[model samples]
Target chain A: MRSVILSITAVLLALLIGAGILLLSGASPIAAYSALVHGAFGDAQAWQRTLEKSTPLVFSGLAVAFAFKAGLFNIGAQGQLLLGAIIAAAVGFGVEGLPAVVHAPLALLAGAAAGAVFAAIAGALKVYTGAHEVITTIMLNYIAINLTDYLANGPWKDTSPGNIVARTPRILDTAALPTWGPVPSGFVLSIVLAAIIYWLLWKTTFGFEIRTVGQNRHAARYAGIRVARTVILTMLISGLFAGLGGAVETQGVVGRYQPGFNVGLGFEGITIALLAKTHPFGVIPAALLVGAMKAGSSQMQFVADVPKEIIDVIQALILFFIAADFLLRRLLRLKAEAGEERLVLSTGWGSGE
Target chain B: MNPWRTLWHYNRGKVLAAAALVVFVVWAYTRDPQIVEAVLASSLRLSIPLILGALCGLIGERSGVINIGIEGQMLLAAFVAFLVNVYTGNLLLATLSGMLVGAVLGFFLAFMSVTLRIDQIIGGTVINMLAFGLTGYFYQVGLVTKGKFAPIPIPGLADIPILGAMFFRNPPLTYLTLLLIFVVQFWLFYTPWGLRTRAVGEHPRAADTVGIDVYKMRYLNVTLAGSLAGLAGAYLTLEAVGSFERAMTNGQGFVALAVMIFGRWNPILAWGAALLFGFATALQTQLQFMNAAQIPASLLWLKQIPHQFIGMLPYLLTIIVLAGVGGRTRPPAAVGQPYVKE
Candidate 1:
């Protein structure tokens, strides 16, 4: 509970500093914040957009959070998400004559599968070749971007009259995810899925294997867990969550996978995951907060005369505070737990070879 | 001989990777000779960022600190260089400015990761996030404007041969990169400073006992590496496109990491590995011509094939080579550990 208060205060402190910066920039902090609040919860329309935007953020956050649980930081969620969106789009457009329920699930499943495969490449390489997931994922990200770009530019291009944007055509209407009045149904799905992920991570046998592998591979191995398999599966599951986010973005919000539109969603997931301390359940509120900030940023900019970049600055500060943890440790006067080292990278990032 | 036995006896990863490469080469060759040349040309050009980026990683990681902020540093350097070069018609100034910016970033990272005992991965990730958003916003807003860096024509090198024209005729940064590779190679192997750096990387405790300040050494190496990465970013705008764009580097930083792995973390090996990447990029371009008649127009997936597989090539090859060679090729004893003084 103290930790929660601390986090909220940290976020508020950042907002105040940001508002001070706005004043220095000749903007009214009060006006900016009011506008931000109004814009985010301004009306049904504003709420819809915010929720629409957050639908993907929730899953991406979950993706990063899940990977963090296994002690593997997945910096490639962006690339994996792209793979998911593109492959899902491919399946959506290519497959013919399937019923609505089957078609929607199939496309969604395909996207998740693609993300898993893409993630598995990094995992498999890590297990087989000792390649770091961070590095491999980064490389794969470039490939994913270009591969998707080429596909959008070439065969999958919307070829509709006067459309110059590099993107795929909208999927069959039946394939799109449903929405509830002002709130996107994807947001609800994301909530449900988050619960499932939390259960899978904390309660299941597989979850135990993952946490064990993350904490200490040699010990996990001694305990008869297939360390390599766990590592790969953890990444796969993490990636599937990320891929679902991409699919949601495509079918629910944008109706097409535009390149720059999904730009920072995955990286933002990193920030969200960190702020949540990589808790699967913690990601929901974290996502909503971030989603609101992102959704309300332009409003903050317009009415408050504050630069939208201030939000990013605040986000960066939050990440710095969390990652450095000097402030948190000082404020709480929390004693270091002897065994809590298992929560982070315990055994030096190695094969223990 | 049973294929499975032979495959299993050795590293199946390498065997599979090698087999894939052979298949690709054969497919490339059977298509068209002219296409091959075009692909070669394309690959070489595309490899510019990767080769230089990998060199940055080699220098940083070789010193025992894992610098994941290479991408961020590169982005910052590229943006700053592009802006400065455009404002002033001086290429040298832009390059120097880029190195300076990179060095500052590197110093800060080293201070945090090395001196303060912060987790290197967290430190690197923060740098990446901060750099990405900072640079991206700067570009979006008019804080940094893009422009051209001076292109120089090499005196005799440009006239020497066909290869010289493509390699030497345009930007001075290219030659500087090539020369720096050798400079780095010589420095790593023959110089006393190089030996100490290697020692720190391999066994920092031993080096510390031998009178080297491990923290100081890492700080210097990381700072130098930041500048190198900055230069690579600068090259993207100044040397190649003559402008800076958002995320201009794409993922060359990762490609560099792969190259570092493939190069066995040796400077010379890094250089050779970089050229291999460059060559692979060039080969893909050449294949475009080959597929002109054979592959259907819409099925032009062949053209984008390299896009999907190119970055992986270095990594996949790294896996193959390392698997075949085994982890006999080791990183510094304390590559990722943050040093804290008691």
Candidate 2:
């Protein structure tokens, strides 16, 4: 209940800050916000766009949140997502004559596997060499960017005449994710995955080991929990979630793997996970809220002459308020609860031991 | 200890750097004699911002605060510096204003990490997102700088064949960065303030017990470090590129973090690491140029490799270096932990 209050308060404060920024920039806050709302929820198309945006966020959010359960910061979700996306595009286009069920699942699994392998590189580095994931994942993100760009432009380039852009061929229709009336099937799959993740984290024994390692590594080690294996497994699963998100984007929305199309989608997962307070199920509403903001940003720009980047600023402010909740607690005069488990993501650099 | 072993232990980084330089010089001589000078000069120019950013990171980390927001600091600083140059047309004022902005950001980070006790990583992420958004939101088309700082070659020193072109003949900021590197190295190792700062980072409780103010040291170190990052930003706009683009700092700020780790948080060694990365970047650029230009028959093999793969050299090298040496290099103890007075 307290968390719910905190989340709501943080959102309100962030929106207020966004309004102040808008006013400072010589725009009417009311007009801009109303336009944003109308664009996001004003009609069926807007709602569909919001759902599409939210689907990726759900996968990425679960990715980061799952890794958090094992005290890992999987900052390489961006890279893993890229790998997943490109591989999925390859499988989608390269494979032919299969039934829709077999082809679609095959492409998705291939993408997921690519992401899992990429994330495991960082995980293995952390477990074996004490190299921090924060730094390694960041480097991997840049490498992935360059690698994906190479594949799209060089080997996977669409050879059809009049196509000059860096992108792969469009996936076969059989590989496409279907949509219901006003709803993307990808969105439904995301919600189902979130529920499954919730169960995995709370109900499974491996999940117990992950949480135990997260809380106290030494204690978990003493309890014979195989801390190193757990850490690697957590990262693998985390990458799988991000990879699945990318696959869905390619198969459902983009229909082809294009350079620059997936930019910031993986990074936005960081914002969503934090706003949800790393809760698997809570990711749904958080993703929806952010998805709505993204969906309406262009409309806000047209209606109010405000830059769409304002949404990013507001999102950052929301994260700041949530991460530093004491500011909100002080403003609201909320009492501190005893024995609260503070969210400390990783034990600094070089604490792999 | 044996004298030779002791010398190797004390100057391992320098020895390795010297060895690498010998190999590079030999390789360049075999490829094209004139290419050596151009690549060396380009490498030094490329390394200026990276060196400054790494120093900024090392200082904050040495004082117990992990600053992952250096990229944001440099990006915002670059944007502000570019704007100041456009409006004021005073290069000095623009550069100083950039540093001032960086210091203010540093203070904000300290407040979040020290006073509020937020997760340091999350605080850094907030800074990054906020900077990206603010810069992108306000950025407009058609804004131009009046002028940029011209290279001021040092007398006699600039006359030297390769060394002069690499170091002496440079812009004002380049000279300043070179001087700052040694200044920082001396200060970090020799000064009383340095000892106190190190104490706070290693063991804040022990530091508090010994009359050192852990929180104050952190605030001071982190805020000062912000100016270094700011200088890096200013260098990007005023020294390297004459114009500002949205997100111009790119990933150099993060690369600076890698340099810091590869150097084990030492200012002097970090400079060497920065130069290595700079060389990688220069080589990549040179290869791309060569590919675009009419290449000699001897260099036909270089054209076979894609430009994107060449571009990946620095980032890939960073990962390899970290995986190889990251475990061996120890960070300051008590880092990323919020201290509370009992």
Candidate 3:
């Protein structure tokens, strides 16, 4: 309940600040926000776009949230997502003549596997070499971006006649994820995955072990847990989630892997995870909220002449309030919850007491 | 403990240099030797921004603050510097304003990391996000046009051989970066203030017990480091490219963090690491310009190497160095922890 309240307060504060900025910029805050709402939910098509946008965000949010359970910050979700996306696109287009049932799942699984392997590199580095995951993941992201761009532009360029853009050929119809009415099948799968992740984190023994390690690594070690194994496994699972996101984006929306088409989707996951307070179940609504913001931004720009970049500002402000939550706590006059576990993300430099 | 033995113990550099020289001689036999000079000059230009950025991390980490927002700070400063230059046309004012903006952001970082006691990484991420949004929005309004600094050659010095062309014939900020590396190294190791900063980062509790104002030291170091990062940002627009683009700092700020780790948090070592990274980066364009087809016809496979792979070299090398060498280097003992007086 406290988490819910805190989340609501942070969202409200962000909106208020955003409104103030809108007013300062000579736009009617109310009209702009109304246009944003209408753009996201005013019609069936709008709802479809919003849901479509939210699908990958949900997956990436779950990725970050799951890693937080094992005291890992998987900033490499972007890279992992990219790898998954390209692999999925490759499998989607390269192999031909398979039934939809077989081909789609195959592509998705290949993407997920690629992501898991990519993330496991960071996990292995952390355990064996003590290289910080944050730095390693960040480095991996740059490499991933360049790798995908190269493949698209060079060897993997669409070989179709008259094609000039750097992208893969379209996936076969059988490999595409189908939508049910206004709701995308990908969005439904995301929700189901969120439920499964919630159960895995809260109900399963493995989940308990991950949480234990996150709370206190020394204590978890004293309790005889294989701390290293848990950390690596957590990262693998996290990468799986992000990879699934990329795969879904390919199979469901994009239908082909293209540079710049999926630029900020993975980063949006960070904002969603933080807003959800890293709860697996909370990711669904958090991702939806952000998706709506993204979906509506263009319409807002078209209707009100407000720059679409305003969404970025709003997201940043929301993150600021969430990270610096003492201000929120003070504003709400909320007492500190007893026995609350403070965030413990990484062990700095050399190992010592 | 003998000096000669100690020098030999660090023989990795000697071996690597000799191997590189052999490769260079072989390559020069097939192509122009001047390509090597161009490579060195480009590496120096690339290393300036990176070295200054690493110094920012060096000071902040030395004072127990893990600043992951160097990228964001640089972005904001670049925008501000370009905006100031566009309006006033005064290069000095624009550069100073850029550093000032960086210092102000540093103050906020100190407030969040030190006073608010937020997780240092989270705080830094916030700064990055904020900078991204703020700069992207304002960059449009600033309406900056072409404003690059012309290269100023030092009289007589610029007339020398390869060394002069690489070092002396450059913009003022590039020279400042070269000097800053030494100045930062001297201040970090030789000065009393530097000792106190290091002490606080290593063990703030002990530092507090010794009557050091741990908070003050952290705040000062982080804020001052922001100015250095800001200077690096100013260099991006004023010295390097002479214009601003959204997210123009790119991942150089994060690469700077890796450089800091590669150098084991020492300014001099960090400068060396920055140059190595700079060399890797410069190699990318040079390889493209001096097309791989130029390689002896027998080495046909080299021609197949794609430009994208070449671009990936610096980032990939960063990961290798971090996993291999950086893992052994210890950061300041109390880094990423907020100090609390008991």
Candidate 4:
């Protein structure tokens, strides 16, 4: 409950800071903000776009949150997601003569599996060699970017007439994720997955092991848990979630794998995870909030003649406030509650030894 | 006792590096005699920012602060420096402005890690996001600079065969970075200040037990180190590219961290690592050029490789090097841990 309040305050404070930036830049804060709000929530179309944006964020947020539960920082979600999107596209377009039910599920599973395998590389490196995941994951992201770019432009280039862009061939109609009225099926899947993850974290024995390892690896080892196995499995599962996000994006919205279209979907997962305070269920609301901002940004730019990047600035400010909660607590005069569990994202480098 | 075997046993990294250099020289000479000088000169040119970024990381980590925000610092500094150059047409002022921005950012990181006790990684992420957003927000399309800094050839030295061309014929920042490599090497090992910084990083509690102020040492070192990263940023806009692009620092800052680990946090060794990585980058570009032209029969198959795969070479090499060396190197004992006075 207290965390909820803190998150709310952080958002408000971030908005205030954002307004100050607008004012200093000689723009009317009121006009810009009103346009932003109207653009995000004014119509059903706006809400639909928000939900579409939120779907990927939910998966990516869960990926980061799940890893955080194991005391690992999965900064390579971008890479994992890229591989997922491309593999899904490969299965979606290349494999012909399949029914809708079979093709869609196959593509999704293939993408998620690719993501899992990619993430496992870093996890195995951490366990066997004590190589820091933070560094390895970041390097993996660049590799994924280049590898995917090569696949799209070289082997899988859309060789159809007049297609010069670096992107894969469009998925078959049967493989595309369906939209029910105004709501996307992929968004529904994300919400259901979030619920399942919450249950898994709170109720399962494996989840107990993950939490224990996160809290103290030495204690977890003493208690007869295989800490190394838990770390690797956690990463694999985390990658699966992020990969699913990319799969959904390609099947639901993009209809194909394109480089620039999925640029920062994975990085935004970090912001959403932190904003949700690493809570599985909390990810939904946090993703929706960020999604709304993203949805409205273009309209805000059009209406107020302000740059769309202001949304990113506001989002960063919100993360800053949440990460440095003491500043917010001091301003609000809130007392620290006893036995509050602080978020521990990682131990320092070489701690794997 | 064989002298060569004894040297290998005592200094394995140096021996391996020398062997690699010998192989590279042989290969380049075989390809084309002039290729050696061209590749070496380009390698050194490409390594300027990387060497500076590694030095920045070296100083901060030696004082017990993990500066993952180096990328953000460089990006922001590059943007500010580019804007200054565009308006003032003075390269010196633009470079100083970039350094100032970096110093301020370093101070902010110090406050978060040392005073507020926020997680250092999270703090760095915040800085990165803020820099990316701010630069993108204010950047005007098609803003041009007057010109970039011209290379200054040292008269006598630049004319002295291939070796001189590799080292002497370079822009102002490249020369400064080369001199800084030796200066930092000496300062880190021979100065009393270096001793205190190491003490703070290794055993802050022990340093605190004596008269040394741990917080002060950290703040000073991190801020000063930030200026080096800022210098790297200035080099990007004012010296190297002569313009700013959003997130232009790319992953070089992170690569610097990998280089730092590969060098085992030593300044001189880090220079060697930066050069090796820089050589990989140079080779990739050269391979692309060869792919475009009519290549020799021996290397004809190289043309079949796609360009994107060539771009992946440096990043993949970083992962391989880190996996090989990460376990062997030890970081500062108290690095990444916020110090609290009892």
Candidate 5:
């Protein structure tokens, strides 16, 4: 319970600091925030878009958090997401005549599998050899970006007589994921998937092994767990989630894949996962908050002409405070309450294991 | 046998990388002889910037820093170098400004990550993001409003045999890249300061016990990396193009990082990897002349081959190589650990 208080306190402090920065930048903080709120959730339509945006963030954030739980920093979510989107789009476009029920899930499966394979490249290297994932994953992102760009530009290009942008042909209608009114069916699926991920992380034996591996590899090995296998598997699962996010983006919202349209969605998952303190369940609200901020940015620009850079400043400040969280704890004179396990996991870089 | 164990047992990544290299050479031959010559030459020429960029990675990481903001550092250098070049038209002045900006960025990163003990990754990310945003904004507001910079090739040097015909013929800025690689290599292996830098990287606490200022050395190396990375950007604008374009470094910073790893974190090895990446890139561009070839005909995937996979090759191969020869060496012990001095 006290952990909840800590998180909420962090959120409030971040908002306050963000507000202070906005005021200094000469924007009417109150009005700008009001516009931000209105833009994100003032209407039914806005709520739908916010939920839509949150769907991808949920999966991607969880993808990153899952890896953290298993003691790897899987920075290739962007690449995984790209491979997922590309393969899913390929299936969605290439396969015709399948029934709607079979088609949507099949495309989704293909996307997830592609992302898994792509992600496995990094995992396999890390496990079998001794490559640092942080480097490979970042490199893979460039490959994914360029590969996706090339495919969209060339062979798989929309080729619609009038089109020029690097993107895929629209997925067939039968392949599209259905929606419930303005709220997407995919969002509900994402929520359910989040619960499942939480279960797999906290309740299951495999989850126990994974967290054990993350906590300390040598200790887990002593307990008869295979450290390398767990690390690779965790990365594979992480890739699957990111892939699912991309699949949802295609079937639920965009309807087609366009290179460069989505720049920081996967990388932003890092921020969301971190802000959530690597909690699977906590990722929901954290992703939603970020989703709302992103969704509202354009409207914020429209209403206030306050450069969107202010949001980045707010985010950086929040991350700064979170990284130096001890400062806040000291400043607030908060006693260290027992049993609040705050974000304990190994980064590939620093942890002794 | 399990694939993982098998991979560990045999360690085929380097063997695979070598095979890939042989295959590429063969493919180059199968294309037009003239085109292959030009492509090889072009690839070697292209290797210059990437070598320098990789060197930047080498300096910082060897001494326990990961400079993800190499892109931003490059951008700042390119932008500032362009401005200085427009006013003075002197290549030396342009290069100095670039190195200066990069050093400042590097120092700033080291201060935050080493001194304040911020999450080095986050600190690096902020630097990258800040660099992108700052440069992007200024290029739009200031440079475009002001004017553009022009490229200046060195006199007669570009006309000499082989070296002059290929490298010197292009631009004076290009040679700076080659010089930096050798200089960094020398500094790392020869200098007493280099030995101390390595000492701090291997085990900062131990170095501290031995009376070396770990924080100070890290700061110095990281800042030096920033300046070199910045010079890479200056070369991009002043030598390659006349003006700074938005996000023009275009992931080269990350590529340099891959080169750093592929180079096994040695400056010379980094230069070798940079050259390979450059060659692959040049081949991709040069292969356009062979569009009508019998080979490129069968493998249209070959067209997307180098562009997509070449970009991805280092990353994919890094894992491959590591698996093949796991633990031949290791990153510095204190790499990425924020030093919050007690």
Candidate 6:
């Protein structure tokens, strides 16, 4: 209950800061916020946009949240998502003459597999070489950016008439994700995945092992949990989630593999995961909130002449409040948690020894 | 095992990195002897911001604060410096403003980590996000072109053969970067303050017990480090590139962290690593300009490589370097830990 109250307070404070910024910029906060809400949920198309935007955030958020259970910070979600997206697009376009069911699922699985493999590299490096995953994942993001750019611009360049951009050919109609009213099919899939992830995190033996490792690695080891395997497997699962996000993005939203279309969706995952407090179930509402902000940003800019980056600022502020919960505690005049005032994310460098 | 053999095993990654670089140099030299000097000069120029950024990380990390927010600091400083230069048209004031902004940010990071006990990485991430959003928003509304500082060549030194053109013919900011490398190296290893800073980073409790104010050292070091990143940002706007672009620092700040790891957390070694990264970046650009007809037909495959592939060189090299060498190097024992007062 305290956690929930804290979460609510952090969110309200972030919104307050956003409002303050809006006022300072000479834009009426109420007018701008009303426009934002209306833009995100006013109409059917607005709802669709919100859902579509929320779909990838859900997957990536779950990815990060799930890895956090294993005490791994998967900063490479962007790279992993990109790999998933491009590979899904590849499978979507490269294969021909399959029904929608077979082709779409195939493409999605391929994307998930690619993301898994990409993320597994960092995980394996951490396990085998004692190389910190943070640095490796960050470096890998750059490599992924360049690698995808090369693939798009070189071999996969769309050669259709009047096409000169760095993008892959459109996926076949059979591979497209169908929309059901305001909700995209991929969005529905992400919701299902979230539930499944919650179950995996709380109900199963593997989930127990992961949480154990996260809470106390030495205890996990004493309890006969294979720490390295658990860590690597957790990353693979996290990658799969991020990969599905990319696949859904390709099939549902973009229609083709374009470089810039999926630029910050992965990084936004960090925001979502943190906002959710690394809870699998909590990711849905958190993702929806952020998705609403993203969906409304352009409309806010158009209506209020306020820059869309304000949403980014708000998101950062949200993360800040969450990370520094003591700020909220002080503001609310609440006491700290019973035993410890802070939570551990990951152990410090070289402490694995 | 013999002691010498044990030491060799421990330093195995460094030896492997050296071998890789040697092989790369030999291969590049074999491909085109003339472009080597151009690449070297470009590498030196490109390394200035990287060296400064790495030094920022070095200082902060040495004080037991993980400042992944260096990128944010650089971006914010770059924006401030550009804004100041556009309005005031005073280069020194603009640069100082950038550094000042960076210091303020550093102070906030210190407050979060030292006072509030927030995770350093999370604090840094928040700072990066804020910097990106704020700079990006302002850039859209207020982005403009400003006059850039021109290279002030040192007369006799600039005339010297190859070294002069590469080392001396740079803007004042770049020279300061070069000079600070040695200064930081000497300070980190030789000075009393440096020793105390390292002690705080490695074992804060011990330092505190011995009457060293751990909080003060961390606060001062982090703020100073922020200024270093800020200066790097100022260089981007005032010297390297004259305008502020949204998130213009890109991932160079993160690469600087990799450079910090590559240098084994030593200032001089970090400088060398920064130069190596610069060389990798220059090599990418140089490789793109290689004449297809000049090279042997067998090596013509290089020309077929995509620009994006060439762009991957620096990042890929960074990954390899980290994977191979990161495990071998030791980080400060107390890094990323919030010092709680007893």
- Index of the highest-lDDT prediction: 2
Residue pairs in candidate 5 whose N, alpha carbon or C atoms collide under 3 angstroms: A129-B323, B11-B324, B12-B324, B102-B226, B102-B227, B103-B227, B158-B168, B158-B169, B263-B269
Q: Say which docking band candidate 3 falls in.
A: medium
Give the alpha carbon lDDT tens digit for every residue of A1-353 in model 3.
77778888888888899898888878888888988998999899999999999999999999988888787888899999999999999999999999999999999999999889999899888888777888788888888999999988887778999999999989999999999998889898889998998899889989999999889888999999998899889999999989989999999999999998887777788889989889888899999999999888889989987887878888888888887778778888887799765676646442312
- Cα lDDT of model 1 by residue, A185-212, tens digit: 8899899999898888778999988888
Candidate 2, residues B1-342, lDDT tens digits: the string is: 343464467657667767988687877666776677788899999899989999999999999999989999999999999999999999999999989888889998999999999989888888988888889888888998889999999999997867888898899999999999999987887798988888898999999999998999999999999999999999999989988998888788888988888777888778888998998889767766764455668777876788888877877877777775533777898889889998
TM-scores for candidates 1 onward, in order: 0.84, 0.96, 0.94, 0.96, 0.84, 0.94
Deviating ranges (above 4 Å) for candidate 3:
A349-353, B1-33, B141-146, B291-303
Positional deviation of A33 in candidate 4, in angstroms? 1.5
Q: For candidate 5, give the docking quality class from DockQ.
A: acceptable
lDDT of 5 by residue, A1-353 (tens): 54556666766777787677677757788887777888899898888888888888898999998888877787889889988888888889889999999999999999898888888888877776666677678877877887898888888999889997888999999899987877788888878988998899888999999998877777999999988788888999999999988888888888888886557778778767877878888888988888888777778879987666555555555555665556667777777677544443214442224
DockQ comparisons of all candidates to the true complex: 0.23, 0.71, 0.60, 0.64, 0.26, 0.60
Name the lDDT value of residue B273 in candidate 3: 82
> Which residue pairs come into collision in candidate 2?
none
Sort by DockQ, best first: what order? 2, 4, 6, 3, 5, 1
TM-score of 4: 0.96
Best by DockQ: 2
What local lDDT score does residue B25 receive in model 3, on the 0 to 100 scale? Answer: 44
| A52-75 per-residue lDDT for model 6 (tens digits) | 889999999999888888888888
Candidate 3: give the clashing pairs.
none
Fnat, one value per model: 0.21, 0.69, 0.59, 0.59, 0.27, 0.62
| Reference-based lDDT, residue B181, model 5 | 73
Across B176-210, the per-residue lDDT of candidate 3 in tens digits comes to: 88888889877877788989999999999998999
